[model samples]
Target: MNQVGSLIFLVALFLFSTFLNWYVFQAYKTVLSGVDSERSKQMLNLIYWIVFGGISIWVVYTFHQIFKAGEISTAHQQVLNVFLTIVVTQLVCTIFLFGEDIFRNIQAGFSLLVNGKSETSFPTRLKWLSIIAIAISMVPFTSFVYGITKGKYNFTVHREIIYFDDLPDAFDGFTITQLSDIHAGSFKNLDAVKKGVDLAIAQQSDLFVFTGDLVNHEAGEIEPMIDIFNKIKAPYGQFSIIGNHDYGDYVSWESPEAKAENFKKFIKQHERLGYKLLIDEHVVIEKDGQQITLVGVQNWGKGFQSKGDLTKAMEGVASENFKILLSHDPSHWDYEAKNEPRKIHLTLSGHTHGMQFGIETPLIKWSPVQYRYPNWAGLTAYQGRFLYVNRGFGFHAFSGRVGIWPEITVIELRKK
Candidate 1:
């Protein structure tokens, strides 16, 4: 956006945050009104402003740094996460307080109509109502804190078995372990990351594939963890495709040449990790003298990068071949892959990260990202074509995962 537009947006956000702070403060006072110790009340008020006001100032400073540098450092990202958590918690409390005020006004209006005179004083704030609001707000406050502390490294494995009538007999019972979105720049704990890599290695799948997003902004981000990731090797082969972030488009560079150099390094990093990086190409995996086609395309989503050419990737491969496609964005399936006349048997993608937060259980699976992408996470089939969207092997923008932990997917392919 233009400079003026950015300034206006920041100002508007500051004003809204200030209003929430003031409104929540009223509820705080009501909840503490019964306390007789003036000193204790004064101390509590001081702590409240120190946290809310301090975080607000930090947020403004972080934004300034981002605007100037065209990048958000890890420290700045964490500060933003903390600010978001506090704002959400305060908004929850504000809802209850606002409702109480409306009820108070209605009661006063009823009294005036009955008595033929306005009440001399407003009704006292309901201490219990405020107390309940504060108590409930803690749920989100604690959840965000836990997410930042531990949830990001909590890797979970998801297993799926898919059967295909047209599958090659030699490829039956073939197991493929898939990972996606290893935003290496966002990782802070190396040991924890290694543990996740080890878990993927232990899966012992026949083929290993990474869908995309090896790094967040630049290739340098993955340099530190190369050894850990290289440990993930499969018997058939390890293959990968590029995601939108791997192009280094999110951050500014000194020149076009510098950005191009970064892109080159990113591709090399894939080679260094022993992955056959496929840029709109196909590779044949032969087992027991029979074969299946594995086609990989560059980032191709509805709104994001549309560089992947399915036709070029599938060239020379017959339409009757049992095919598995490596695509970074699930929207590719929604927009192109699933609708192709040649019929791709399976497509793997992992761009959404399930918003890194949502509830997933046996009965209900919901995330805010589902509204934007039809196939946000897990397995979904459309007209006999299947798409498996991995939740991601790492965290990003938010710095943590809440209900949806980082994922490693093991998919077994069987002949029907």
Candidate 2:
């Protein structure tokens, strides 16, 4: 957005947040009613406002920097993370407080109608309800703190064994390690990142594919960690396709040539990292005289970039050959890949990052991203074709992840 538009948004957000804080303060006062020491209560109230006031200043400064630079630095992102955490926690508290207020007002109204007089001077705030609200608010408060401190780097490996009826005999049990959305610019802990890379290397899969989003905005973001990622080598080869962010579309550039130069550097970084960057192209992986097609396309999605040319990428490849597609966004599979006449046996993707937050368990696997992209994370099959959306290897706009931790996906292809 333009500077004026961004400024207006920030002002509106500030006003809304200020109102939310005011409403939540009522709950705080009710919860503190039992405190014996007036001084202590006063001090506590002062501290609460001070903390939120400081957060407000930080947020304004961070946005100002973003407006000036056309990009958010890692430090600025952390500020946003903290701001979001606080706002969400306050909103949770507001929900409970608002509900209780509604109930109390209704009770008061009923009493006035029935008795012809108000039973009480005013509806007293329920201390116990306020306490409960505050207590529950801590859950998300602590979770957000932990997510920032540890969850972003808590790289989890997800393994899926996909069965295919037309799979090549030589390719049975073939494992492909997939990583996506590295967003190298967001890395804060190099040692932790190295551990995730080490884990990917330990998988020792036959092939390694990075779906996309190597950097947040520019190619230079990964320059510092090229060697760290280069460690992820496989027996077949390491291949990559572009993501929406790699084109430098999110940030401002002095000229079109500058943006083009940045993209060129991004492509060069892939080469330096020992990955064969594919743009609307296909590579055949041969094992024991049998071949499987690996088709990669540029960032194609339902709402994002649609530069990926599936037909062009599949040219020359036999329709019967077992196909594995490297697409950044799962939407591509939902909209195009799965319905292709040539029949893609498998498509690997990562762009959602499972929204970096959600619950995933044996009985419940859910993230907000699912509402946007149906096949968000893990394995989903349609008409015998499989799509595995890796949660991502790094964080993005949000400085950290919550329940949906960073992921390294390993898919074992088995012949049905």
Full-model lDDT, candidate 2:
0.90
Clashes of each: 0, 0
- Write the residue-wise lDDT of candidate 1 on 1-416 in tens digits: 56897788778777888888889999888877888999999999989888787777778777777777777789888887888788879988998998999999998888778776755456888998999999999987888888888999999999999999998898889999999999999997999999999999999999999999999898999999999999989999999999999999889998999999999999999999999999999999999999999999999988898999999999998889889999999999998999998999999999999998788999999998999998999999999999999999998778888889999999999988
Q: Highest TM-score among the candidates is held by which one?
A: 2
Which clashing pairs does model 1 show? none
lDDT of 2 by residue, 216-240 (tens): 9989999889989998899999999
Candidate 1 residue-pair clash tally: 0
| Shift of residue 42 alpha carbon in model 1, Å | 4.9
Residue pairs in candidate 2 whose N, alpha carbon or C atoms collide under 3 angstroms:
none
Tell me each candidate's TM-score: 0.94, 0.94
